[model samples]
Target: MSLPLPRDLARALAFFLAPLLLAPLALAQQSGAASPPPPAQGATKPLPVFEIPQSGVEFQTGDTWGQNGQTFRLYGIQSCIRGTTFTNPAGAKLDCGEASIAYLAALIRDTKPRCTAVAQTASPPLIYTVCAAHVGANTLDLGTVMVTQGFAFAATDANGKPVNLQYAVAEGEAQKAKRGLWIARDLPHPTAILNKALRDAERAQ
Candidate 1:
């Protein structure tokens, strides 16, 4: 049997179909609202920097020499003696080695501040004793800063065992030297310093 369609029913169906066709537009608007915007490209934060004392030593990025603003290392210059070692605070031993103070000092004086450096050592009671000026520029980097200081040690025999020997280390250059420093004991020579200390100790006893 054939049935007749109602006019109201046809109008309601058209209205519902019109909204269904526009559902994609509604979904697009909802998606835009739900997502966050992308961050700006090439944006970056700056690095932080801190200041240190002007007189303080500035070490290289990977340097192990400096601690609490002071830096130090072992230096070697030509010496006349043999078979001696100085123990560091860390319990490591350095053979005093040997070098000429006159030669080492001259080298330091002639060398350019940032271009050249003589290796040497400086510890308390004998600070910066290896170099002439007690300060030098780093050869590896011109911008890096360094200072040398002299120290005196009571000279002993080939072993670290102390004797009545007093020695003065002349200032030399930047960097650590295997020869230690050219040392003067009592007079301008290494022998005098060792002899003086031994004589003095004997007299005291």
Candidate 2:
């Protein structure tokens, strides 16, 4: 019954109504009534959550563990290797490596230990981490404890310098107390022992 709108008039009306048509959608978004779209395919994945075992942990060495098919090495500490023997101040033969592992295991017993990755090595696929073990009201830094207890040495860089000064201090304290490896009259540094072992292996090869 109404006459057809003029073409120019019809176009003008549509232009004016465009924003009005979209107003509800805008309001819905602003009011949190609409959800965001899912991420696009091939998006980067989120990082995995860190987890620790409920039961106490056991170490393959004072500073390393193999879990879930991955090798983890403790940061800022190094321990003697199995078959590495030294003499105690009491003139007794001591298997330093075994003793280190035993000491670490004892610390982990009945304690919930958790570790966060701090570094990684590619040559041997090792993850270096700082781990904390809860004991009563105190939280123990496992790596620092190892050095302080003289079961392990402060780790060193390729230039044979201490990796961390805090660990160095811990080692110094252990030395002063004449604990574990430090009890030896002629204490052999772990780095020197490791280097010598490497050289010997190369010569044998």
Candidate 3:
């Protein structure tokens, strides 16, 4: 066994080592260098958001698709789930999910939006992304269009809280205006459906 460090020797070593250990931070602070803000709780660092190629792009739903063997979804929007229906003004029932998918596909065709992948999720390895498209003289975030136009919804966690709060604001405006799917009296909200599913799964467990 090694001999215990003498109290005086330990004190002397610490006194001499403290300044060396602290010098870089002190110098950085003195030079006005700033450290990057820490990532949000339970959040990963976002990947670089470069323009994704349009080749092999396929629309799987209103808010998700596959490209180059990778699945990608809009960062803050949820498409209506398949098998849901809503009423039109003629009292005829329309498939809400199909409508969302159709609208998204049309927008993609017309606008040819460019996206930047930001994060990835597991279970099938889905990428979350933000996209932009030009409409007239203005460039718009694609999620804003999807939610604000009432075709899609502000995406939420299992707790029913929006993943991106700004999308919630847009959704509110769309709701107040009663646009697109919002005009239907029987629109089945994705968040409601998802939350119910979560609760059901928990109860089953």
TM-score winner among the candidates? 3
Over the full model, what C-alpha lDDT does candidate 2 score relative to the true structure? 0.61
Rank candidates by lDDT, best first. 3, 2, 1
Output the better candidate (1/2) by TM-score. 2
Enumerate residue pairs that collide in model 3.
none
Question: lDDT by residue for model 1 over 1-205, one digit each (tens)?
Answer: 3333234222222221222232333234335755322212332322111222223443211111232443322122113222344454455554332222223233334442222111111211111112222244533211111212222222223333222111222223321332223222221323343444445545666
Deviating ranges (above 4 Å) for candidate 3 = 1-56
Comparing 1 with 2 on lDDT, the higher-scoring candidate is 2
Residue 106 CA displacement from its true place in model 1, Å: 3.6
* Per-model CA lDDT versus the true structure: 0.27, 0.61, 0.68
Tens digit of per-residue lDDT, candidate 3, span 1-205: 3344444233322222222333344334335767522222454546445554546677767887777777677766777876678998889998887889899887877778878665454433556667898798888999899999999987765445666677899999999999999999889886676555545545666
Error of 3 at 120 (Å): 1.1
The better candidate by TM-score, 1 or 3, is: 3
**Cα-based RMSD of the predictions, in order?**
36.3, 25.8, 17.6
Model 3: lDDT equals 0.68
Where in model 1 is the C-alpha error above 4 Å? Answer: 1-105, 113-188
